[model samples]
Target chain A: MIRTEQAEVVYPNGTRALAATSLTFAPGAFTVLLGPSGAGKSTLLRSLNGLVRLTAGKVVAEEADDLREPHALRRHRRRTGMVFQQHQLIGRATVLANVLTGRLGYHSGLRTLLPFSATEKRRALDAVARVGLIEYALRRCDQLSGGQQQRVGIARALVQEPALILADEPVASLDPATAERVLSLLHGICKADGIAAVVSLHQLEFARRFADRIVGLAKGAVVFDGSPSKLGRAETLRIYGAEPADNDEDSEEPLQLKTGTHA
Target chain B: MLAPSAGHIGILHEHRRAVLRHAGLVGVIVLVCFGALWLTGFFDAQRLIEGGPALGQLASEMVPPDFSRWRAWVGPLVDTLAMSIAGTALAIVISLPLALLAAPNTSPNFAVSQSCRLILSALRSVPELIMGIVFVAAVGFGALPGVLALALHSTGMVGKFYAEAIEHVDPRPLEAARAAGASRFQVITHAVLPQVLPQLADITIYRWEYHFRASTVLGIVGAGGIGFELIAALRVIRYDQVSAILITILLCVVVVDSLGAWLRKQLK
Candidate 1:
C-alpha cells in the first residue's frame, strides 16, 4: 500500500494547492479523487509520485526506500505509472515508439540510446494490443484521434508494468461516450492486473460509476472519503461547496454503482 | 460631477503627454538617420555622377569573358564546396552540446546557461571573413583556415537558434518523461530531441547554404577556394576572368540552395 503523511503543496507564489492531508491507496483498489477545478485533486494525485514535491510531509510505500532521496524516488517512480490529461505522446513519433518509452526507466540511460531488446519490444506490443491500438502501432500519434491518443498514453503507462497507476483527468478532453469507454478500458485493465489506481476526475458521473472508493476534496482539503454508495447529496454539497449544476438530471441516482459490472 | 471631470482632464493630459513622448522619439530617430546618411556622404550627388563613367568602363571590361583557365578553376570550386560541407558538419557537432548547455530548460544551472549564451554572443560578434583572416594567420592559410572559420562562426549562430528551439519545446512531454522515472539525459534524448530535431535540421541546412557563399569569400583571405582564383584574376587586371568566376559562384549558390530546399522537404 502507498500512503501520504500530512502531505502538502504550497507553490512558490504562496498558493496552498493542497493543504496538509493524508490518504492511503491499497493494492487492487480503484480510488477516484473527486473534486471541482482548483480543488487539489491533481495536487494529491501528483504528490503520490513526487511530481508535485511536497512542501511539508512525506509519501511512503510499504517495504520501499525513503521517497525523499533521489535514488529511492526514481525507483518509486519506475514502479508507478502516470497517465496525463494531455496524452503527452511525442506527436511525430510512431505509437510503438511512444509506448516503448515506458521501458526507459528499466534500463541505463546509455542502454536506451540503442534499440530496445526484443523482449522489451514484445512488452510494448502487448501493451499496444491491450489498449486496442495494435493496428495503429506503426502510425504516428499525431494522426490518431484524441480518444485513440489517450489509449496510446495508457499503453505507454501500462508498458511500465507499474504496481501503482496515477491518472490525472485522463478523459477530461474526450466526449462523454469516449470518456466513458476510455475509463472503462482503464478500469478493466487495472482490475485484471490488480494494480492500484488513483484517478482524479471532475466529472461526477465518471467518479461515481468507477470509484471503488470516492475521496472528495474542496479547497485543498479532503471533505469526504467513503464507498461510492455512501457519497450522498449532503457529502456532494460538502465536497463541491454547492450543488453541482450539471448533475441535476442524475441527482436522483447520485452514485450510479456501475463498478462491479465492468470489473 | 466636478471631481469626475477633473479625473477625465487628468487622463486626457496623460494621453497627450504619451503621444508627445512617442512623437519626440520618432523625431529623434529620423534626425539620427539623416545625420548618419550625411556623415557617410550619401548626399554627395556630384561624386556619384562623376563615378558613373568609370563604372561603365569597368562593366565593359568584364564582358567578352575568359574561360581559358577553366580546368584550373575546377579544383578550387570543389575545395569551396568541400569546405562548406565540412564546416557545417563541424558546427552542428559543436553546437548541439553547447545548445543543450545554453537552453534554460536543459542547462544544469543559471551560471552555465548564461556563460554558454555569452560564448555564443562573443563568437557571433566576429564576422566569418574576420575569423577567416585570423585563422589564416594562425594556421598559415589553405582550405583548413576557411573550414575552421566557417565552423566557429556557424557554431555561434546555430547554437543560439538550437537553444531557442530547445527552450520553446512543449514542456508537457518533458514532464511526462520525468514522471516515468527517466533520467535527465534520457528525458532530453527521448522527449527534447524528438521535438526540436526538425527545427534544428531546418536551421542547419539554412546555415549550410549561407556557409557555401561565405566559404567562397574566405578563399579571398588565402583560405584556398574559388575566391582565390577571383582574387588572382583581379590582381592581374583580368576583369573578364573575374566575371566568369562570379558567374560560376552564382550557379553553384543556386545549386546549393535547391539542394537545401529538397533536403528540407525530405525532412518534413
Candidate 2:
C-alpha cells in the first residue's frame, strides 16, 4: 500500500495543486479520484508516482524504498504502470511494438535495440488479445480510432504487469459507451489480476458506479474519502459545486456499483 | 491585449503613422544601399552589353556537344559520383551523433547543446569550395580532398536540420518511456529513434543530392572531379568541350535528384 503523509505540492507559479493532503491506496482495489476539472486530481495522482514532487511533506510506500531518493524512485516506477489521457501511443509504430514498450523498463538498452525476445513477443501478443486488438497488432497505431487507441494504451499498461496502475483520465476523450466499455475493461482486468488501480475521473456517475472507493477532491484538498455508498447528494453538490442542475447533469443518477466478479 | 477601438481616432491615426514611418525607413535603407553600390562602381552596364556578342560566339561554337570526348568525360563523372557518395555517407555517420547532441531535449546539458550549435555554425561558415581548397592544400588534389571537404561542410547543414527535426518531436511518447523507468539512452532508442529515423533518412538523401552537385564544382579547386575538366576546357576556350561537360554534370544532377526524391518518398 502507498500513503502520502501530509503531502503538498505548490507549483513554481504559486499554484497550490495539492494542499497538505493525506491519502492512502490499497492493493487489489479500484480507487477512483473523483473531482471536476482543475480539481488537483491529476496533481495528486502524479505526486503518488513521483512525477510531481511534493514541495513539502513526503510520499511513502510500504515494503518499498523511499521515493525521496532518485534511484529508488525509478525502481518504484518500474513496478508501477501509467495510462495517459491521450493514450500516448507511438503513432508510427505497429500496435504490437507500442505494447512491447512496456517491457522496455525490464530490458537493457543494447538488448532492446535487438529484437524483442520470443517470450516478450508472446506476452505482447497476449496483451493485445486481452484488449481484443489481435487483428490490429501489425497495423500502425495512427490507423486506429480513438477508442481503439485507448484500448491499445490499456494493452500497453497490461503488458507491464505492474503491481499498481495509475490512469489519468484514460477515457476522457472517448464517447460515453466507449468510455464505459474501456473503464469496465480496465476495472475488470485490474480486479482479476489483483493489481491496484487509481483512476482519475470527472464524471460523477461513472466514478460513483465503478470505483470501490471514491476520493473526492476540490480546490486541491481531499474533501471526501469513503465507500461510494456513503457519498450523499449534499456531498456531491459540495464537491462539484451547486450548479449541478445548470450543468445539465442528472441530479439523481443511480449508483449501482458493479458486484459479482465480471466473468 | 486590449483591442484598438474604432472610436479612438488618435490611436487609428498613430497606427497609420507607424506604418508610414516603417515604409519611410525602408525607403531610406534602399536608397543608402543603392548609393553604396553606386559609389563602389559595382554596377557595370557597359561590361554587360559588351559581353553579349562574345556569349553568342561561344553559344555558336557549342552547337555540337562533342560526344567524341565522351570517353574522357566518364572517369571524372564517375569520380564526382564517388566523391558525393563517400562524402555523404561519412557526413551522415558523423552528424547523426552530433545532431543528437545539438538537440535541446536530447542534449546532455545546455552547455553541450550550445557548443554543438557553435561548432555547426563555425563549420557552415566556410563554403564547400573554400573547404575544398583547404583540404586540397592539406591532402593534395584528388577525389579524397573533394570528399573530405564535402563531408565536413555538409555535416554542419545536415546536423542543424536534424537537430531542428528532433527537437520538434512530440513530448508524449518521451514522457511515457521515461515514466516506465527507461534510462536516457533507452528512452532515446525506444522513443526518439523510431520517430526521427525516417526524417533523418530523408534529410540525408536530400543532402546527398546537393553534395553531388557541389562535388562536380569541387574539382575546380584542383580536388579532382568533373569541375577540373570543365575549368580546363573553359581556360582553353573550348566551348564545345565546356558544353559537353556542363551537359554531363546536368544529366548526373538530374538523375541523382530523381533517385533522392524516390528514396525520400519510400521513407515516407
Candidate 3:
C-alpha cells in the first residue's frame, strides 16, 4: 500500500544516492531489498519514515495525504516503524521501559512523564512477549545478547503497531544461525500481524529463502524485481556483476562483500 | 640473533637523541620556574626551619577549642549550609536547559549552541570569590549574594559536564525515537535523558560539594557565612573561636559528602 514515485535523493555533497525509482510495496508481503553497501538501500528505507528526504519525487500511501508535506509526513511516519542495524535500545533502561517509548509520539509530554496507563503498559508487555523476551522485561539492555538486543529493537518497533515496517540490515551483526532465526521471526511476525515489511540485506541466500518478493539494487538502481525463485545464478551475476568467490550454494560465506566493492 | 641493519641502528640513535633533548628541555624549564618562585619568596623552606618555635606556638593555641562562643557560631554554620543547598539547587535548574542548548547534537541551531557555550565560559572565567564580592556590592551583604555567586560558578561547571554527557549519547537510540514519530522534545526526554541521567546526577552532586566549600569561604568577602564569623574572631584575637568554626564546617562537609555518596550508590 506504500510506494515511491520517481523518488530521487542527492546528498548535500552531490552524491546522487538514489536515482529516480518507482516501486510499490504490497501489504502483508515480506519483500527483501538485496544490494551491495552504499547501493541506496539504507537511504531508501530511511526515506519511508521521512528520515531522509527525497530530492525530487513523492512517497505516498493510499487514502493518505502526499508524504512530502511536513505535517502529513510526520503523521505518515507515526504509522510507519523502522528498525536500525544497531540494536539502538537504551542500555541503561529496562527492556519494558524501552518498548514503552514507542508510544511517546501518541501521548503528550506531560503524560509521558507521569506514568503509562494500564492499557498502555499491557500493550507494551504484549509486544515484549510477542518478541519472545517477556522473561527479560525488567532486565537492562546491556545484559542481553546481540540477538536478544535486536529482538528488543523489534519489540520497540512492534509496540508502535505500525502499518509499514522498514528494517535496514537488521541481522548484519549476528551469527549465521542467529541471523536466520531473527529473519524468520521477523517474516513470521509480519505475516501473522498482516503488516508489510521491507527488509534490506546484503545476503542473497536468506533473501531467496525468506522473501515472497525480491528487489535487488546495484549502482543505486533496482536491477532485479521478481519472485524469490527467479533469483538464480544468472540474476545473482547481474546484480553482483560477477560470480561470487565460492558460489557453491552451500558455503556460509557472505554473498556480497562486506565493504560492497563493485565487481 | 643476527646484527641489526644500519638503518635500524640509525633510527634508534635518533630516537634516543630526541628523548635526551626533551628531557634536557623539561629539566631546564623546571629549574627556571623553581628559581623564579624562590626569588619571589612564595615558599621559603629555610624560614620555616628557623621559625619552628613560632609554628609550634601557633599549633598549640588551636587545640581544646573554646566552646564558650559556640552559641554565636551556630547561626553562621547553618547559614553556610543553607547557602550551598540553595545555590546548588538554583544552578541545577538553570544549567539543565543551557546544557541541552549547548550540546551539538541537541541544539536547535549552530548559533544557539555557540552562544550558550560562550555565555557559560564567560561565567566560568571569574572566580567565585570575585563573583561574591561583586554580588555583595550590588545586593549589600547577606547570604543572597553568596548564593548567587556560588550558583553562577557552579552552573558553569555543571553545564559543561552536562553538555559533554548529552553529546556522548548513542545516536542509534535517538534515531529510533525519531523514526517512531517522536518530536524533538519527546526524543530528548525519552531517548537522550535516560542514557545520561546517572552521569548528570553525579556531576550535579560533585558541583554541590564544590559549592559547599566555596560558600564557606564566600563569607570572607562579606557575603555572610562562617568565613565572616571566623574573620571577626581573628580580628579580636579569638583563635579558639576560629578553631571552633573550622571544626563545625568540617563536620558539616563530611556529613553532607557521606549522604551524597550513599545517594549516588543507590542511583547506580
Native contacts recovered, each model: 0.62, 0.56, 0.70
lDDT of 3 by residue, B1-268 (tens): 8789999999999999999999999999999999999899868878878799887877678777877877887898888888988999999998999999999999999999999999889888899999999999999998999999999988888898899999999988998988888888888898999999999999888777777788889989998988889888888977777787888888889988988898888887
Mark the regions of model 1 whose C-alpha exceeds 4 Å error after superposition. A247-263, B1-32
The residue-level lDDT of candidate 2 at B59 comes to 96
Task: Put down candidate 1 lDDT per residue, B86-196, tens digits, no spaces.
Answer: 999999999999999999999999999999999999889999999999999999879999999999999999999999999999998888888888999999999999998
Candidate 1, number of clashes: 0
> Model 2 over residues B62-174: C-alpha lDDT tens digits?
97887778898889889999999999999988898898999999999999999999998888888999999999999998899999999999999999999999999888988
Q: How far is candidate 2 from the true structure (C-alpha RMSD, Å)?
A: 6.2
lDDT of 1 by residue, A1-263 (tens): 89988998888877788889988899989999987677788889888888889999889975354578888888888888899999998999999989988887887857878988999999999999999999999999999999999999999899999999999999888887888899999999999999999998867877888999999987788899999999989998888767776533223222322111121
Candidate 3 local lDDT, A7-75, one digit each (tens): 888888777778888999998888999766677899888877788999998888753557777667767
What is the lDDT for B10 in model 3? 98
Per-candidate TM equals 0.92, 0.90, 0.92
- Best-to-worst DockQ order: 3, 1, 2
DockQ of each: 0.60, 0.53, 0.70
**Residue B144 Cα positional deviation in candidate 1, in Å, after optimal superposition:** 0.6
